[model samples]
Target: MSYAGALWLAVQEDLYTGICNGTRENGDINRPKIIREESKGCLECFDDYFLSQCFHLSRPCLTFLLDFIKTRLKKNVFNPVSDSTSTESIILATLFFYAHGFLPSKITAKLGLNHTFAGEAVNTTSKILSELSSSFITFPASYNDRMGVAQGFKNISGIPNVVGVLGCFHVKVTPPPSELSLFLNTLGYPSVTVQMVSDVDGNLLSVEQCYPGGTREQYVWERSTICQEFVSFRHGQTWVIGGRGLPPGRHVLTPVERSQLKTSAARRFNITHSRVMTYNQHVFGCLKARFQCLNDLGTVQADALESVACIIKACCVLHNISKKFSVPLPREPVLEPVHPTQDVKGKEGEKSFYYMEETREDMIETCFGQIRDEEEKEANTEGWL
Candidate 1:
């Protein structure tokens, strides 16, 4: 309420009370009214320190995102100055909404927006940002780029030919419409299963939103364009590494197929591959760490899975941009293994199981077998000496 309206309401309350008390007749009930001063609230709004802790970005970083929006909007729906909701404010509202996981009402109160305007700003900003997700989060384009990421994975435990790491995380939602059983996950919560691929640097390369948190990561992969392109391109000797949630395939490799590996060579390869895959853990560690909206982790905050998923996609872009600026990672505590950012198993997983068995053995022989041979030669040389 405005200052004047609140004053009038208080005065009316006093008069009504006087009449009810019978302290004054109708003539005396109406008199000049006194209004107590309104207390000051929200002393600080969107401060730099607060933005860093809240929105996970400094003022400069926020401004950069805003500027990107400005340029993109110049040719479209945005009227930076004339629009009732300034582009800058919309971006701030979106960040504030997700950063703190606050509702539109609280956003209105804290951000000082008019009632109901916060939600609009959030929706508008989210749409704008999501549309540009591809502009912000990009996958490897050239062969060199693929090799670079592969080399990064190779650095971890000397694992090679790893173009990327695959993973999934659930974005919680209000109990989805009861009709949609697919939206409910194993945890008995409504969510959207988000599948993502990150380079060894923990930068998100590709992200696809899938429904029903219970949907397996491998199923999502089989249906994803990234997987299709990967399989079709067959970039020589390059493949992404994933958890057992996905079948060992030509497009994606899992640790040296434990069930089939009967030799020491395969065992050595599996040991190293397992260690390198933990880098996926760190990537997710960094992701949910940077974007709190995705994790129910510290606090039980949620929204519509679709909206949350879109917000997450937008944040993913910012996550990439923030990396370029060297924004400090969040100080979130070490996450337990139960963190939602992990894997999924598909019903069709069985069909794809032996899909790449030959490819797997060949890769083992061509990639990891050499390592075993070198080790054996060195051990024999040492014994001879």
Candidate 2:
């Protein structure tokens, strides 16, 4: 049987057994009564596709996530009133809110619960998950982990020693009451800029969301804690690739400009660099597609910037978890191309430019030189023939 069908059978079996309590509440007479058994039936009947659609996660992932966070939730979320709400319900409510960007009232209405309960559940769940961010989104600390990351990127485009793709995503938030300009990004929307480093499969290795939307990418990177950690990666001979506009550093490589390509090796390097960046782009696309809340969190209260940050972080944790299960996106993700910028402003920026230029050149020679030499050798052989 399919997973959903098997789950239905299990729920049916549970109904006959004494495992489920028959107690149910109908706070709203217009809404259908929800009991322990029915809730299991509803969730279990979710085939993988529908599960991913409603919750932005597959059954395997949802199951794993619940088990993973169960101990933490019990310790933190258990209370007199909350005892009635199952862990599954809390997760389902939070996932629905994240996937649909629905208000707590709407989510509770759909789940046949009161607004207070649903709102609390959503907040508590998001808070709990956000607290678990370090567990889900982690940088490769061990040598083997770093090597694995490097190998994954090397497989992508023959790029050597790349541990992650450095990128940023703009999360739309409601216009704040004060200093509104701080939240407005280049797109003229009130947003929060989230810096992230994604692996080859688009799983986030590091996440930082301390900056306002209008903050410069370079400024965020320079001040980020991960930036310091990457200096260690550089010492380990592992680096990350960033997109256009960001100045490269000892631990970061950016795509060389087309005009600056002096050889076939450089041209190929640029193409490959662009291709690798698409992985980063795909990640943002998938993230927003799965958790629509990130697309526009404008409904949030103006003063709830901390809540917004928590929600974004929780969504990122969920994104990485969904990626763990290999959950397919419900729709095609829109990928934005990397755009170049000449706004390298500062002494540090200038130094990074020159330093990474040499690094990029060395990479071009080390990684692609052999292929270029082979091409030349083939041309000579053809000429002889």
Q: Which one wins on lDDT? A: 2
Count: clashes, candidate 1:
0
lDDT of each: 0.64, 0.72
Q: For candidate 1, lDDT tens digit of each residue in 86-140?
A: 5455666677556555544534443446657767667667767878878877778
The residue-level lDDT of candidate 1 at 154 comes to 79
**lDDT tens digits by residue: candidate 2, 1-385:** 1123245334424332322344333452322233355435345544455465556677888888767655567787354233434666677777877876764453455455677787777777787888999999998888898898899889878988888988878877777467678776666777777888999878898888656777778888877888877665533877788866576677778877767878888888888897888898898888887887788776444445677778888998988887777887767788843433436556443464466668778878888888988989999999999
Global local distance difference test of model 1: 0.64
lDDT of 2: 0.72
Worst 10 residues of 1 by lDDT: 37-46
Error of 2 at 158 (Å): 1.8
Between which residue pairs do clashes occur in model 1? none
